[model samples]
Target: MSSINGKTIWVTGASSGIGKSLALKLSSYQCNLILSSRNKEELLKVKELCGGSNTISILPLDLTNHHQMEEIAEKAISKFGSVDMLVNNAGISQRSLIIETKVEVYEQLMQINYLGTVALSKAILPHFIANKSGHYVTVTSLMGKFGSPYRSGYCGAKHALHGFFDVMRMEHEKDGVKVTLVCPGFVQTNVAKNALTADGSPQKDDDVATQNGITPELAAKKMISAIEKGKFEVYIGGKEVKGIYLKRFFPKLLHKVVLKSHVR
Candidate 1:
């Protein structure tokens, strides 16, 4: 088991959705929590919800600001002396078609989702290496493993995450660092509403599939389980999880099925 109970865990995007749920759930484990997001007010609210105890700290973060990750990482380690886990759950989504999307949108997607995550992880890598133990839990989308119609740039960024983390795992396993890549189908969250559209504006609307998906609480629980079990990668969802296998062994079929489902 991963001894997550007594260690320190830093969660990005901890203001809401799965990140908030994870903060709430991890609180019971008696672990030191560092909650981060762009919304300091909301993060303070979550910190209070977790009993407002000293065990939990809030560090406001904007993943797009990659240049500051090193400084931020240093501060995080100083908070509790060391961090045992870093959950890369902060990212944006897309809701635009390929033809209508602007190049700027694609660039923004890569900046926030792929490059930002890589930057933060790299900032924390040396700490983990020196300590000889760390875990990276990335909350990507099922779209990471396969292409989707409307989320072209989103899929591209998520796919890029898989490649980078896979290499990171290969090189760092000997250093006692583990990587857990989580591809979720959809758990009720504001992802759809916050998704960037063709012109790089927020969709600011609810999606039916998203609203009806599993709760963020449930997703958080499953994610913790995967982390404790030291899984290389885990998919969480209803039938949508079958898409992973389909994409692997039956690419053409998965493509046809995805198109027929009309995911947006």
Candidate 2:
């Protein structure tokens, strides 16, 4: 049996993509799930698809509203008595060049993708500390490890997560809290379609790389394995994941390649 069996897991962004896939995957493990997203109706649909009315509860949430995160955390914990794990998967993406992107766009990405995750994690810290056993799984991106063209704001936000979560892991290690940063290169999802453009409007179109990416279900399985093994970080996706390694081992070479690729 999986170590996740019977655990109470709260998954944000459960309406679609990796979050939805992870919810469905965890359902088969017999875990109690509290699924959250801004769209209540979509959350219900995902819950129904999971086929476990008794084990799944829907909680509509907007990560951008950081002020309410503490209350949301309480509600999540109340649902299953205590939340044993939190999957901080709710986030937005950007598809604009740094110079073309507005300042507000940067703030929007930081608020939703970085600050929101941090706020929620802080809200849950007390619970995790009291229990002395809890896990935090955050879905970052390969961009978090290195920058890419047209994703300057997205890269900044994701990079911020690495710094924040790393400190969290270090300080909370003695409290028996586990933190796993899952960096995905690209998985077939609406992320590109929903990405913010230079004018703060949705791109409304998918990227070629995203269209050819792996299925969200496959990514979820790998994430679960990383979580079970208590990995501090994991990279998922196609050859794009190799960029992370190249950046670490051959910075000058990767720099030239990134500029030449003209990604986006």
Candidate 3:
């Protein structure tokens, strides 16, 4: 297990939910944190809640801005000298059927969830390579592994991340780079509200299962532990997350069960 104390870390999507909670938790450990999100005001609120002005800095970033990623990376690295770890937690979800979904909706999802993440990773690769160490912790969904109805584009983007990061791990193992893909079930976050719809509008925030989902603080603790143990991947959530494993081993039964379930 590794200690987070003194580790220079950056977390995207830090204005709310998992990223916000993680900032608070890491602040308690005295970790140097650089937090980013499109909402600068909300991010400042999170930073204050973190209770460590000396250890926390807020840098607003919109992951969808492909042209600005290099600048974001430079700002992040410049603050901490060299980022020991990066939490790629910025993303949007879509909850519309494929047929009803617009092409632009799919493209937007891919742009933010897949391309943006890859760009950030790529931007920091040389620094990690030079230092011979870095960790990447990505917050992907269970949908990445198990396809769900009304989320064709979302699943596609998440699934693409698995392939891209898996290859990164394979190629950079000797370079001391680590990647952890976090597959969460329903988390109580604004992600549902910001999720894309058929016409590329917001989903208006309806999370039926978020009430039973684990608290973001607890989830952050679990994630930190996984990072400490150097785990390659982890699933955080209630038993609902088990569907990912069950689907792999019992495809027929899972399919039948999912067909009757009220997930959407």
In order, candidate lDDTs are 0.94, 0.94, 0.87
Residues 1-264 of candidate 3 have per-residue lDDT tens digits of: 247877899999988889888888888785899999999999889888888486788889887888888888888999968799999998998888888889999999999999999998998888899999999999888888888787899999999999999999999989999999988888888777888999999988677776667888888888888988889889889987878878889988878777777677
The alpha-carbon deviation from the true structure for residue 81 of candidate 2, after best TM-score superposition, in angstroms, is: 0.2
Q: In model 1, which runs have C-alpha deviations exceeding 4 angstroms?
A: none
Residues 1-264 of candidate 2: C-alpha lDDT, one tens digit per residue:
789988999999999999999999998887899999999999999999999578899989898889998999999988989999999999999898888889999999999999999999999999999999899999999999999899999999999999999999999999999999999988999999999999999999998889999999999999999999999999999988889889999998898998997678
Is candidate 1 or 3 superior in TM-score?
Answer: 1
* Candidate 1, position 29, lDDT: 86
**TM-score result, candidate 2:** 0.98
Model 1: colliding residue pairs: none
Query: lDDT value for candidate 3?
Result: 0.87
Which pairs clash in model 2? none
